[model samples]
Target: AVPEAADVDFSDVAGGAWLMDHIPWTEASHRIGALNATAEIARVLRIAMGEAVLSVERHTWRLNEGVTQVWQYFPADLYHLSARFTPNQGPHDQQAETHQQARPTDSQGG
Candidate 1:
């Protein structure tokens, strides 16, 4: 997913402006269902925030505040399956030539 222009700014007003680009809940729901069957959707959602990720189970449902809570048929077996939000370290910092170079003479005891 491409980074949304709004995500680059941290100001409240700037961030709030992004609400206008919010995907329709109905459409997200459909996509979630379709994704559950074929993809690891949590990774896709991570692109938007670039910080937090969203995870969901096929049996889960959205309850409120864009939050999805797990639903168990048995009351005694009720449990909460929450999303694990992990911060991304952006891209790795490395040069192609660094990896291609062999060990130096010092390390090789030459």
Candidate 2:
């Protein structure tokens, strides 16, 4: 996971799971699209793309403030994507919200 890396220190966190579990992420936005292997992604993922690849970009917020951003890439032939959204409740539940699930697939099966 690529973090904003501004004021974050991961030395105390054992792994991504632990970090995520400890933080109360209130909101997040995602963009899923086909990208022909952008230069930065190509260099980072170390693959030469002959066709458009799947790119998932996400930005998460804590208490309505931006916290982290992450990007993931996958070959469309190898994977499918799914997401679930639930609004934060309890002290932050000022408005009613709906639960949503999104499943995106290509030629590959989930």
The top-ranked prediction according to lDDT is: 2
lDDT of each: 0.30, 0.63
Q: What's the lDDT for residue 9 in model 2? A: 63
- Clashing pairs for model 2 are none
Model 2 alpha-carbon drift over 4 Å, by segment: 1-15, 81-110
State in Å the error of residue 32, model 2: 0.8
Q: How many pairs of residues collide in each model?
A: 0, 0
Residue 3: error of model 2 in Å?
12
The numbered model that scores best in TM-score is: 2
lDDT of 2: 0.63
* lDDT string, candidate 1, 1-110, tens digits: 22454356556454324533543122123112111211333344322222332233322122333522342121111222324333653334321220122323566584
Off by over 4 Å in 1: 1-8, 11-17, 21-26, 30-54, 57-110
**How many pairs of residues collide in model 1?**
0
